[model samples]
Target: MSALEAVIPTPQVIERLPGASFKPLAPAYVRIPKPKPELQQEAIRIADLLKRNHGLDFQVAVGGTEQPGDIRLEVAPVAGVPTGKEAESYALTVQNGQLTISAPRMRGWYYAAQTLTQILLRSPEVPACRIRDWAAYPIRSLHVDAARKYFPKSWFIRQIDRLATLKINQLQWHFSENEGFRLESKKHPEILSKSYISRQEATEIIAYAQDNHVEIVPAFDMPGHLGWLLRNHPEFRAGEGEYLTRMLDYSNPVAVAFLKELIDEFSSLFIGQTQTWMVGGDEVFPMEWIPKELAKRTPQLSEYAKRNLGPKAEVLDGYMYFLCEIDEYLRLKGFSETRAWSDLLYITNLMNLPPRMQIAYWTQWSELMPSTQKLLERGHQLLNVSDRYFYYVISNRDDCAYKKHVEATEILRNYEPQVFSEKYPSPVAQARVLGSSYAIWCDTPETEDYEQITRGIWPGMAAMSQKTWNPSVKVLDEEGFMSQLYLLAKRV
Candidate 1:
């Protein structure tokens, strides 16, 4: 096999050179010419990775010119490449017994370090090659349902480092769900009745993620998936039915106000850290129980619809009204965009939804849900978290376990950010896609421990890193991919 093929999320350009492999000599240094703090951090990280993986003795020497056998990190324009200045793009060249990593931005330098580490993992001697690589999508991400499973802060920190190595830039922490609320809330201390991630720990996780060139997209799913919150304040519940209790009562002014405050309390914590907030809008009243629950709502819902939606608005319009209120509130809290699942079926017109909202097109399980093509044509940007391709549902049930295994092979062969359905084989233009993500929904939290969860997701996550980084590239079959993945796998 070509040594270049060992690199995951394959580079856009690879040119093999005629020379001996460049192996780092002992007492080598990761030479950083510039004294920028960020560059220093990158140099330290690269040096540590080399030490851990290859047992090479390397030191991070800041403010130095490159010497022989030195791994150099530089922040400068990548010459000769016409489109080299994009975000997270990097060029790596090994020649003249030295390895140099160059990019125009911090993230590019970080990714170049990752590519270098991956190549070195296959063998201590680096192949003589030049690789120019960049991500096709800007928001390559992974959504973890910690709300259900309650992973510790260390778990998130570990995963962020792992993800950064694969060039996955975003980690969406789904910290709220019907079963549990994983974030500590001082305002509502009772919500921390279950295992939770505290405020200080979350801050640490965010800092760690940023250091590793990863952004933490905090997801506090609202309106729906409110079982844990409603359990403490049942007055805010829409209905007493089994499923209805999971949803917030949008009709009640007091309830909506309470939720807005709740959102403000937690969202304010993440204000400076992240610009995007995910207000999960999936699997609400779009199913057969819509009418049954609609009738349960007091006359306040109708009043809310008429006043906020329109004079002739129906009960279902309440969803859009509640979403808009939350969206507007998030904007006030300094969020530039809100992300949600594509279950806004009650929205009669596209103009009614928030302009800054990006849709996570996860499912077409509901016939009433809008088609992926329709949503794109109507000018909504989408992140394809297609359930068929990307969901890793960990449950004890036979069907759920089957789904976890079934999609593993399928994703390796055919999944990509633009793919939502097999029926619509034509992919949407890259301009309309923000990127894609693999989702780990722990429907049954106790079914597996954190180690088990990581093991379960390893293969799928490996496949996803490749697919999201460059969706159109040729992929290895399941067996080939897994073999290469195991050879390249390093937990740290």
Candidate 2:
């Protein structure tokens, strides 16, 4: 059978004729009714995809009325759908040489369009199919840390569009860090001016991400990794002491106010009823730095640390104080999620946190699985972003892993059932395991060959996605799965 026949096999020919004359469907004509901004955009995108893949011509129309066509879309509005609803609730009926999709909201319409697109992509000869699908995870997400290395706005938008195609609904944008801050914060102009390439570039990227089905969750690394911010505003530092490169002074109310204002500006720009802010509370090193700074300014700190934490515990005591203060400030401003590397959980008393607060466990070390178990036992939600499974940067480049001399091929080989069985499946893991994310750390992924990076990561990440989506799915036969990947790549 030919490629077209293989994708769209005819039951009658298979049963009786063995080989029969068959003609594929003609170029599709799509008519969109009551098209809103999002629905229209989705329809256009679907049309473009069809044209690119199958040489199908789509004639699109928008109104409250109906027209004779191969496919018809009716877009309407609904009330009960959650905030930032991007799809419509549509009913599709195909009969008598025409297909129709009717929905009450733009989100529903967008969803219906996506279903149609998938059907067409999967089978060119089949013009009709029925599907009723919505997102399983309410907060389907992707997290990209631009602070480690900045990706251009166009590149960011391309990633967003690709995720939207896969039905992934959110983009957690790590916008600021010690290495660089990418967003245009109103309170701190110097954040982008001193750190990023340009502020206009950041805004344009935000707009592009929004245009796709992804919501951008802006993260600003605070307290521990605020060195870049402090470099610009020396007054924000805890002490005259030059360890300012390491930590911020939470004892200073001025510094607290700075964070509050930064969050407020982020809320105005990105956060919404459905989307939330991620104040990164991870990788806070040199715990003693803050207490020492406070010791010089406030003579009481020395006595306080000695009395409460004992002499040896002074550093940790000070770090915990900073974490608590930052968490409180974010809560006051209506932020819901706070992400930190797994190490933070072991060192900090994060149990009994506010209900709005959610933690992201970035598995950097082997101990992260145990830390995740501990946090889950304390009744907290977590996003699993393990470097072994999800770090895309590591998979892409040969230079990233010197210890193993691992290339993409080696990374893919190492990611078989052995790794999953031995390392990933800790004792007490469950569905509260919200999802898995592959980190595209900017350091290694600086080149234009992002497609190769994506290829190396996807097959392995697909295993992770299956594990997160359905734990019962077995990790057997890597060769079989790799063959599937090659077939999928050829089709695309």
Candidate 3:
């Protein structure tokens, strides 16, 4: 039999190893040859943790190069350990009462270190025998949309650290929206200065997220949901153009210039090798306003409304043009990835997007299957975020029993089968399902009492996380999951 087949545990055996009962092998020693400062620090931290928590010496050493042995805890044991190179290999061995871990590169070593932590934390018994493992998804992601409702930076980073513990790699930050503009934009100071309560606070949160093994993908809602920006700068709002107006003057050249400058400023603030900019193109309501303005400017523009019953078609056309302009501006500024709500597929042909652009399929509406299908056929990557299953906001109120929220319970009940099941075939033709995200909109959660919100959503979100992480993983029972979630939340 192959090594992989040999290591596969039987269902009966797997059932015995609950997440809480897992523990690492003890009385271990780690060896690293010519370790850099970061690796060295990690080694020391592991050793200290072992000594403090388990009363094990957990010795660490820097020594001459050697191949890694099979083991749960492998310290770097080789000289010439590469740093920052992608796709490097690592090995860990625990054979004949000796344990060794070695990597050709530092990134590999870092990964090995993470794996060691997981095995140590998640296995029911100490891993006394030889074992080997590696990452399956290079881009394992967890997204938090702070734009809709801001979360404390401390809470954000704490969650990042917890995600790193689970080996999740990417943290997508939905940073701007129509409700509030969360990031600082110096070029258009009006964007954040007037809309957001604090800009430096948002930057501090980004810095904290980066420190905890998470790559932040910041999103700014454009074209349609520029209401927050328009609220701050009346000139950017459509004529009748009062501050707090819901629509932007997309036809105005000055407004376009302001948007371009804001995009540039955002690009500069988040300058990093791994950062991605998400420009949201979703939910353009009040189509009547856009066409009314257009018809007033040029009576002949009324001809564009031929397909539709009213002037709404002209308004939608103007909105589509605005979306394309934002897409082009971001492309020119070196941002390859731009995400929008799934509706962008139906409202406008996102055919003008750069080849690298990605669309987030926010399947909140019931009739989103067709739109999702069209987006995939158009050759764009999609992130599935079905609200019924993944939205945390639709939960029981504080005074209500969990079952009292019939709509919320119904959503949780049907979410899994509806979104991920083979029975509900993907609407997208090509099926480029990048992953999924659970949106925790905090409109009613104004008091910042996350405990109640979290408690209400735990069982559902945990199931969502599992489905996102491993599609074939069995759906867990609610009671069993809640018991586990309580333990996990305490750790967080």
lDDT on C-alpha atoms for all candidate structures: 0.77, 0.52, 0.50
Q: What tens-digit string does per-residue lDDT give for candidate 2 at 351-427?
A: 24444456666553443223555667667666666555565553246656521222333334443221222244554
Candidate 2: lDDT over CA atoms?
0.52
Question: Candidate 2, 472: how far from true, in Å?
Answer: 6.0
Better of 1 and 3 by TM-score: 1
Candidate 2 Cα misplacement greater than 4 A, ranges: 1-69, 73-122, 127-129, 132-136, 185-187, 193-199, 234-244, 286-328, 331-334, 346-351, 364-370, 394-431, 443-492
**What would the TM-scores of all predictions be?**
0.93, 0.69, 0.70
Candidate 3 lDDT score relative to the true structure: 0.50
Q: Report the error of model 3 at residue 56, Å.
A: 7.7
Candidate 3's residue-wise lDDT over 61-102, tens digit each? 666433333133334333322332223335544443344556
Q: Over the stretch 1-492, how does candidate 1's per-residue lDDT look in tens digits? A: 455776777787888887766788888888887677877877887777667667777888875767767888777776554452277788888887678888888788878877777776667678777888788788878999988888998889778877887788889998888888889888888876468988999889888888888888988777788898889889888776776688888888889888887787887667786789998877766477555546455456667778776777766676777777788888888988998888654345523576568989876655667777677666678888877767888788876633545445677677767767434446778778888888888888788898887777777887787888876678655565666677665446
Residue 442, model 1: lDDT of 86
Q: Which residue segments of model 1 deviate by more than 4 Å?
A: 63-65, 79-85, 290-299, 398-402, 422-425, 477-480
Q: Which model, 1 or 2, shows the larger lDDT?
A: 1
